[model samples]
Target: LLIMFFTTGSFADKIGPTDGNIVGRETDTVTLKFSYETSNEYILLYWYKQDTKSTPQFLLYKSARSANSERKPTDTRLESTTTRDSTELTIRGLKLSDSALYHCALR
Candidate 1:
């Protein structure tokens, strides 16, 4: 099986994916990377996946630039690692159902 992903975000804020058209195979672990620029003391990062004929589903979110940050994922297989400038979403034990356009947003 093959899974493909893409990202979307605001160009004015300089936030989006580090790569586009990523591919992964069944049972493989894939990590999607995104970068953002913000001068605020804190920022929220979000991840979503959209399959064909459907809307994007919220997967997880993480907080950056704060020690008292928070994170939550909709699935146990979904995990997020975030820093002040970048965030990465890792999906483990991939399945064909994972094929979709993944999106990242900064706020």
Candidate 2:
């Protein structure tokens, strides 16, 4: 008899504001870059708002699989664009609410 196993994980890296500047008013764009080792999977990029006593809320985008995915919440203040495979995310019209830890995962 033989045994085999499989596992899944992601390689995440932060992009943009890498200098840790207090990103808020005046910041026009936020960009992030990441790389992964998987194929035929969808990637979900999320943004949240950090609060003192509560969980973060969704800020700008979600469920983006390709560089051409559409922005959500339709306020015309948030926009996202990406590059295939390389995993680059470009966000426009950044606001205070757009401040939070950005995360990416394969789904």
Candidate 3:
């Protein structure tokens, strides 16, 4: 499977995926990492997944500054981890349908 990843942020607030594309097999585990920098005390991040010819779907959102603040993912196999300078989306037991473009946004 092939997965593409992207990120959105302001000029000063640098953010992007560690890899633009990734290749994996079924049942494999993949972690897409996005590096970000911000000065605000409150940090919120959103993750989206877009399949071919489909609108991006909201996967989840997390506040890096708050450990207990986050939106649970619709899928149990999906997990997110956040830090002061980066965030990651981890997909477990990957399938062919998991192949898509992922976008991460920082606010």
Best by lDDT: 3
lDDT of predicted model 1: 0.78
* Candidate 3: tens digits of C-alpha lDDT, residues 47-102: 99999999999999998875458998989999999988989999999999999999
Q: Compose the digit string of candidate 2's lDDT tens values, residues 7-90.
A: 123445323322232344444765555454445445555444444456555545444444334346454655444443434345
Off by over 4 Å in 3: 66-68
1 or 2: which has the higher lDDT? Answer: 1
Worst 10 residues of 1 by lDDT: 1-10
Q: In candidate 1, what are the lDDT values of residues 23-105, reduced to their tens digit?
A: 87888998888888877756778788888899888887788887446567757888899888898988899898888888887
Q: Evaluate residue 82 in candidate 2 and report its C-alpha lDDT on the 0 to 100 scale.
A: 45
Q: Which of the two candidates, 2 or 3, achieves a greater TM-score against the reference?
A: 3
Tell me the lDDT of model 2 at 7.
19
lDDT of each structure? 0.78, 0.44, 0.90
TM-score of 2: 0.46
lDDT of 2: 0.44
Report the number of the highest-TM-score candidate: 3
